[model samples]
Target chain A: MPILQFVERDGILDLGWGHPRPGLLPVRQWQDATRAALDAYDWQALTYGHSAGPQPLVDWLAEHLGTVDALTASPGEFFVTAGASHALTLCATVLAAPGDVALVDVPTYHFALRILRDRGLRLVPVPRDDAGIDVEALGALVDRLRGDGQRIGLLYLVATFGNPTGLSVGEPRRTELVRFARAAGVTIVEDDTYRELGYEGAPPASLWSVDPGGPVVRAGSFSKTVAPGLRLGFVQAGPDVLDRLAGIGYVDSGGGLNHSVALAMATFARSGAYAEHVARVRAAYRSQRDALVDGLRAGVPGLDVPRPAGGWFLWLRLPEGMTAESLMVVAERNGVSFAGGAQFHTDPARGHDHIRLSFSLLSPAGLTDAADRLAAAIRSVAG
Target chain B: MPILQFVERDGILDLGWGHPRPGLLPVRQWQDATRAALDAYDWQALTYGHSAGPQPLVDWLAEHLGTVDALTASPGEFFVTAGASHALTLCATVLAAPGDVALVDVPTYHFALRILRDRGLRLVPVPRDDAGIDVEALGALVDRLRGDGQRIGLLYLVATFGNPTGLSVGEPRRTELVRFARAAGVTIVEDDTYRELGYEGAPPASLWSVDPGGPVVRAGSFSKTVAPGLRLGFVQAGPDVLDRLAGIGYVDSGGGLNHSVALAMATFARSGAYAEHVARVRAAYRSQRDALVDGLRAGVPGLDVPRPAGGWFLWLRLPEGMTAESLMVVAERNGVSFAGGAQFHTDPARGHDHIRLSFSLLSPAGLTDAADRLAAAIRSVAG
Candidate 1:
């Protein structure tokens, strides 16, 4: 058994991790894809590849985004990365210098915030409502930072099926965000890692699609849709941005981030196995989401559980006066665990009353059971 | 055919790239390894893995380094990276902030220079003789920089079979360099990527191994020994350094740089296939190196070609009045290509009389033909 399996075997009913459940991973398809990739390519498959990645993969991605996601990006705009985090790191490297300020959603993807901060960008969290990042608030923040002589270099947003919050910015808000970024002269980085894994219908039009050739940079990943193990993702930006990213010393020296694996994923994409796997995963996640929501509503009283249009999470605002910290203690005692909302907050105190539950890694039945346990925990905490 | 095969199919004899020859790549073995990795491991293989990379791979690497490379390092000292360049980048990110000084060899690996410079480090080139980087010069340079109030953050060296120059530091120099780093309070980053590729025998002791627990960071890669496309490498540093690297938000958020690939490589290592493959490659490289060296000696009179103890390169100093640039023009016209020594120089003008030839990617016959063509081009340029 792998170490993770051994560690996770204690049956804690984990709802904190957002990894796709095991049943959703298409192991057999990947086996075929790996075999086919090896058989199809020569030693070039194992040699230093193009810094932008395999051309076939790049071309396939362009077509897939255009036809499937309705995001029309040319091959020149795309550069393969190790994953979404890697792509974000590349963006941070190019768009912002150390000490520059990046405006992010208040309760953003925790890791996304970490990635940006790690690159030495000062993250200024902009508040968000049910619709997503409040565009007006972002504009005000950008103006305030600029007035203070702070260089607002980047605007990072998980615009579609956002992590932790499960919020998708409406199409109009995406356009507004892009407009605000353009006016502020800041590059808008849209992390669309969960875009393809929407449990409902497709998420809103990507910020890149809404404002093509604008300052919007879209980062897409196969991690959520296909398999995280592949560590394959791509960034779509304007020609100038693409050139800048491609010229980074890391890519220049190492060639593309991940070569053979990218080709294998390309094989998977070209063979249409990728789309098939995504569809299966989407259906599984949709059911898992429904089960969790239904169980939560049925078991918990006076809980505010917003129905996520799409994405992996169900954001729960606990009953008034009940802190997530206090409830989490009760929940753990009752054999359930979840990501504390405080972990996602830029200001930890702001998220004390909420919790983020990820249904992606649990079965429908598992999620239902988790919901019951969490409800009991909440009641115990409230009492 | 993959794009690389098409690009390389042209009749130009490329003596510049240092990739393993196609025949030397263990394609069948990797296929088996991939299958075995997936079969032996559970769903954890496809999930976000431990931030420090799979523990098994880390343990295996520790054992391999101790037994095979004669370098003793605990697992805590190792942090897996995407590749040697990635390892170097991480070292740059942590050891030196931007504007810090990194002392490097004058005519070093061009890409190494680029990776450091890309991280915004001020690279100070210290002179090097045939025995690799001059320890005395490095110490003097450090003293000067410190006196100037400039922080000397890192001393980067490819100690074993140095790239482009193919010069390995003697054991005594390794100790001297480590001691100097300790005295100067500067971190010594010993890039030992080519250590295992020694044709005749094992290379000199790694700087880290020479002075364990000293201020030495050793970077190793399977790129040369196994395959570059795998994008796998490791840095063996003190526990503190490893912890800092592992704590980098990029690694933490991404759950390790490349998990599945690392696991796959671990499977390859544990299976004994890696040892067999390395031995086979070493023998092939030895023959190719001899062929290139013999052909060059026989074809070109008064040429200064140092027989490398191991590694991929044959560094050549042309006869008087023959610049590498002028020879390269004639060589390309005659269907041969080499890395002009100027490309490796900190100041391009200094390497006008030098050139680097790599035999790792060519068959013995190919190397012989390339050498003959190169000789003809040299004669043409000399005239």
Candidate 2:
């Protein structure tokens, strides 16, 4: 009756989606955090919490995450959410409306696209370069759209380690883009969900840091670092902007985020375990990313594998004649699974030759085997 | 700026809202649950769970909650959400659309009204009697609205302890309402957030249990029974309907509900401690409710307070010549805070003479103090 149930019965590797790997989940850590929260807070932990977040966690996150990037906000600016996805959805609700146009990257995070669509907004897809969303093109597009009599609603960009592509928009683009958006009377929703697992050097200044007039809203999550199951994320924006989002949240969940998750995140942030935990994650994923790239390159000579800088994926352009759907069938038959390219595309059918492989879920040994199987599947399909 | 920060700084007691008192949260139980979850499961908990929910929580809730009302659901039929509010929002998204008319009772929850407005739906506010939403009037309204060429959207109702009203629609009306909805080809979003806080005898038969094939989606929350801070709730609907909502959830939050929250809810459900805990909550709220009613009735003799059947609220209809807003100022000056009833209505000005007092946050002593303060405020305002 509903669309959610229909296609779900068919099993997919789910690499098409972004969720924390089981191995990366700090189960004991989260439990310890939650238990500590419960024991310390009593029934109060279960009742309700501050609309922004529980104080300790927000304070700790503000302090700890500051060392990772330039944060324009103190703890007071952060509002916790059910997850990053929920945070984005709230942003969509507060910022976008029917007939309004939001500038989004082409082949963007599908969920973000869905958020805009669900909010009844017109999504203007801006072309992106390898470094990240192409600023020149974005400027031109905004100008062209305006020239064509369109009113740009807002600008949404994932600056660091974006989903599906794992490409970070460079420092120059982040600054210039925010500036352009400010000039164009657009607010920027900067999503930094994957900024923490930095296999690369330090991240550039955040958009929030550069914009002082309250045009930038930054949302960060603990999902990629300590554990995704915790489902804790926070949005930092101008107080006035945040208040509107909070009003929507007050309506949405009475509160958007769970207090226990906040407590656990606080514990993790306070203990400074997130840093060490995320470091280990980066190393583990680095090995996996390398292995995946090497395996694809060696096993499938014609494939083009873009080695992700920090995240857990290797986006591969399949060999000529090999469709992701066909390869998926072959892989499934061979007892190995990875996401088909189509799942990531706004238009699923057009990206049949692309595949997303996650080293995050596979062991070193499993990676070798999976790569071999995947290569065989591709070869069979291509041949 | 993030939305909540401004609201937090405004120094508003925010009693106009439904955020549970943080002091009542069940932190220890959640911590224990999370800790156990950590030791027992790994990536399974971290990665994407089933769209409906973690199987254990769903199964446990199905068994435990079934005693309250029979639920005809397979695993695929249940969908977890951030909270009851999220469930209702999804119902609005999937079932109602722009140009559609959602039939609501007058003096309904304001946020639901906002959601309907946000979705561009026409709201048909049917008048209500003290007994609850007038079923006969609802049927006529449905016919009248449908006759006027409006597509009847979903029937959004809160049956077990309604918000603001603190009234439960009687059983006969509940059954008749379901049948009426079925005949009209309309779906019903049954919110039971306060079901566990019943101060009276057996509650009405939930639409989900009474009419299996009718378009009824049952939403239940752990916020009232256990703690609001966990932000755990679920929707029980037909498999197909649940699936469609889940599909939107995939875009909303990779997964709808937080895994840790789900785990906490599961532990709370399976521990056999839930019933006792809920009974304790009910007993505590019932005492507070009685105190609130007594105070309002005696302290402000001319005020009309329909004895609430359950829930933590006492809605007071001010004596003639007094307005809720003006009285609220006096109450605050006297150090007692309550939400002016106007805030709960789509048209706040129309409810200027009504007030909503939450009894859950006040202890026996506090309730007395509040009552005295309220009495003085009403006297001053009336004079």
Candidate 3:
């Protein structure tokens, strides 16, 4: 029994952690902003801000997000959360009540599932393929659950590059999913956390962006694009839903937001350096994805490595004999770490053979080393 | 319809808002800390911190609270939350199952009620007198509810300076509450948001502090003492519960607490400024509380104003023939604002006669003005 046992086994290059890459953090600028804020704005800054988060950041995100006419925001329509996860938790709090079920993508972001579960939501997993969460399958799941006398409160989806599986919901499927949710009276919580990391052609319009007038809640964050550490993120919900979240948030933080973070984020977004910074981040992760996939193919044949279109993770399926648990032990022995797949699944029995490797946290060199170490560990364990 | 409607009709003396009183905020020192952290520690400072919140802040709180025994805190027992409300929301998420009930004190902190209700838990309100949440009544409610086959999963209370009521749970009742919770096998979420504002006898040892062995999940904050706008708070739970909360916390700001805040709080605590600052705040509130009560007696002869033992509020009962709604209108017209009782209650029918006023947010002069205005309004409406 170790004193620091909660950290579990360390030095496993935690691809499991979802923080913004440290290198991408605008440390100097943020420090400057914070210092200035503390000096001049500390009095008001130390009190609660508006529950919707800092107004300048909201104004910046609205201007920068480029959502279609289908999506417009007034100040009150935006709610600030602790992070993207906090946003989802708030959404879960307001949208899903007890005994209500939230429709989720199978093999979805684990945090979303955890949030829903924590809120006492009966999670109905909508099956997904490589093309992203199946729109038709979603319709079927909603109907099946409804038929079973269950009320589907919301359909949780990641419209841009999703976590665990880095696949975006295609445009046609997005439209179909919205249509299905509207007809089923299921609200959509479209998590766009990884939207900025897209390596493909212009990303699909957000579900909220496409729905002319439907039940859709779009959540985005500075965690991925700017810095997750700043703990600044926003959700644009329909007025009714946003109002509910705002009421809850008012109780939560009394609108006390970190103005310096908001200011830094606003500055980061305006720095003309944002596009370049994002490109640098994506290129680094894109390269790591290519490296990790290539490493599996070349060094550890038989592991099924899915080449992600965008985002930091590469979801791997070990060869027939190996399990994520065994691989985790071997990887730790070799000083490389990845989230054991079993931990991510809502249904653990179905997720044992898979593991998620994040490429974004590691530098290209570190990622290459991690890949080689993980490859060897997997091979030794499997053999 | 107005794009945004506020609950502040009587207008908030605009007080009741908690955290460091605005005038007392250490703007200059915070500016220095912010600049130092940003310029020197920018790279690491801007990314996501541990999901539980910043490590240093957690460490500081663990030491400062000095309430819980050190034996209880292994590596995982302490965690940082976005705020106390964030901690409570996570507590509700982790502890309450949908269709499950959470027992709360009647005339409890309004926001706690909202947070519990938002999670779809039927708030089983147990009545309270000066000694804090009535333990005998709570036991009866549990027995009655249990007989009804309803499961109560959590017992939520504010031990020190109970919000709204401004009472502390004495040691005997504290022990009894713990005994009652253990008998019911329900976890207790003790919210000590105003512990530092103690103006009278020594602060009662927290139930969590004394009965470190029991299942009490404690939440504390820098907001009330240092600055609420900083949005800095922590939750101490059993390791299993804390881990679950940490996992869920990632979705929110990735538990990216304001490190600058953590540093400032740590600085404030270490510098011994906290106790001195709180002393001044206590004296101010005690004076204002006395003034408000005095004025109500002299000016509004028929009103019932309970002198709060601690914290910044005076819970007032409207005179016969006076409605909170109408009195609020008159109060606002006379240039004073107060939080109406309806916003804090789950049942509108029960709380309409109540109005909550905060003297903390105003100056002694402002308090006089507010009391005068409120007194005039009461006479105008009731006479």
Candidate 4:
């Protein structure tokens, strides 16, 4: 067995990690995929691949995404990357120059904040509502930054089934933002990682698909839908944006990132296994979400829990004046851990009353137990 | 088959492409390695890994590199990467700032030049002789550059069985350069990609090993010794330098680059498959080198051909006044292709008379035929 990725304590449930439960991973399917890939291998499959990625994987992704988005996806619009994070790095380091302002959703993925900051890009928070990023506020913020002589390099959002909040932007709002971004010469980078995880009805039109060929560049991944270990993701953008990504120092040096895996994934994807897998995964996560919500409501009074239609997280608003920080101590004592909301915000004060729990890491019964433990922690902390 | 990485001509012997031939690529071994990795995997192996890499692979690499270099390689000194090129990109974009001057060997690997240049670093050519990079000249060059108010961010060298020239820096020179770089406060980024494919004997001591725990940062890869498609490699440096690499934006977001492949490679190395494979590869390459050298000597009169002790490529010089540009016209007609040396230089004029022919991509007999065609091309061009 490999070393554990995170620290674990006996008798404690980790609701903090926003990843799939061990049983959800297609270990057997992966072994089958590898054997198939090897059986159909060519020598060139093991050589330096096209800088855009292996064409077979790119074409496969294009077809799959096209069907999901309900549009004609062109192969030219794709560039395979190691994963969504690496694609963000391309945006942070390549599309945006250092010190440029990155307009981001208020309570974004905590790690994505680190990615932008580490690359020397300044993160300027844009407030969000139930429908997702407030377009008017984002426009004003962009204008304000630009007026202060700061160049707006990119506008990043987790548009559909977003992390930390589990929110999706409304359909009309998506179109408006794309139009505004293109007119303002601001590139919109959609972290479309959780788009396919919708347990309810279909997701809204993707920002990239809303216009098909605009500044709304996207980084999609098989991490949530398939598996993270593949380290395989792709960029959906116009030819100009992809050319710039491929022309970077490292991409040129290595013909393509993760060429062998790309070929292997292509085989897995082509065989209809990937689609079947994600369907089962979505159903499993939906039931887990329901169990957690039910337990939390019955056990913790006056707590506000916004049920997510899809994806992994449950963004909860604690009772009046109950900060995530204070509850974290009691939660740990009660043997449940969760990510505090303050770290997800650029200005910590904005998220002090929130806590984010993920249902993806446990079964329905396990999540219900975790919810009870967390509910007890909250009662103790709030009392 | 997937889309071809390079354009293939119907009748041409492609001596210009420098990579392992189909016969040498170890397809079956990779299949075994993947299967072994799957059998031994924990779910965490498919999760986001530790940013430095999976510790299992890190420890395995330390032991393997330690034995190869005859030094006690510490796990503290390693950070896993995609490959050497990706390693260079990390150095170019992360370690060094955009405007920093990069001092590189003249007639170095051509693509490496593109990697440096693409990342916005200015390349200052450092002259070389049969002994490798001229230390005295480099010292003077550094003084000249610093005097001109340029900050020297890096000095990159392929110190072992270097590309194009196929010549290693002499042992004493390696020590001197390491000492000089540390004293000068210049970080030496060693591209140690070709260190393992030595033919005649154990190659010279590595520069990183010459002065362990110094300012030297090395990027070693399985691309040359194993397969380019693995996209697995590691970085060796002091903690300070490693901390800097792991702290970068993309790395922080992704956990580690190519985590799954690293695990597979760990299994391959621990099984003694890697070392035994390299031994066989070295033997095969040694004979291929001999075949090309013998053919060129017999067919091309009055030409300068330096016999390489290890690695790929044979550096050839025209008798006089004939440019690599002139020879390319006739060589194409004779059904052979080579990389003109001019592209490998900061100043194209300096390498106009040199030509690089690779032996890694063909059989000994095929390489001999290619050399004969090249020789005829050279003779015809000169006349």
Who wins the lDDT comparison?
Answer: 4
Error of 3 at B167 (Å): 3.5
User: lDDT tens digits, residues B55-166, model 2?
Assistant: 7787776666656765535555677877787777777888887789887766766667777766677877766776677878787877888788889878777877787778
Q: Candidate 1 regions off by >4 Å?
A: A5-11, B5-9
Query: Against the true structure, what is each candidate's TM-score?
Result: 0.96, 0.90, 0.85, 0.96
Reference-based lDDT, each prediction: 0.83, 0.70, 0.69, 0.83
Local error of candidate 1 at B195, Å?
Answer: 1.1
DockQ per model, Cα = 0.53, 0.42, 0.36, 0.55
Global Cα lDDT for candidate 4: 0.83
**Cα lDDT tens digits for candidate 2, A212-257:** 5368888787767766666678788878777786676344446536
| Candidate achieving the largest DockQ | 4
lDDT of 3 by residue, B226-344 (tens): 66666777787777787676565344425445544555455555556666766766777778777777877778775667776777777788886667788877887787767777766
Cα lDDT tens digits, model 3, A183-254, are 778888988888778676566678887663368887777778766656667788777886777677335445
Model 1, span A86-129: residue lDDT tens: 89999999899999988888677888888888888888888777
lDDT of 4 by residue, B1-383 (tens): 24545667889998888878878877778777878887898566677777778777888888778766858688888888999888888877666777889989877877788888866789998877778778888889899999999999899888888887888898678888888888888889998888788887777778898778797999999988888887888889888888888777677666778887888788888888888888888889888998899989989866667789878988887768998888888899999998888887889668888888899988999989998998898788878
lDDT per residue (tens digit) for residues B257-368 in model 1: 7877888899999999998988888889999999999999888877777789888998898989888888878898899998888878777568888889999998999999
Give one clash count per candidate, in the order shown.
0, 25, 24, 0
What DockQ results for candidate 3? Answer: 0.36
Flag the better candidate by DockQ, 1 or 2.
1
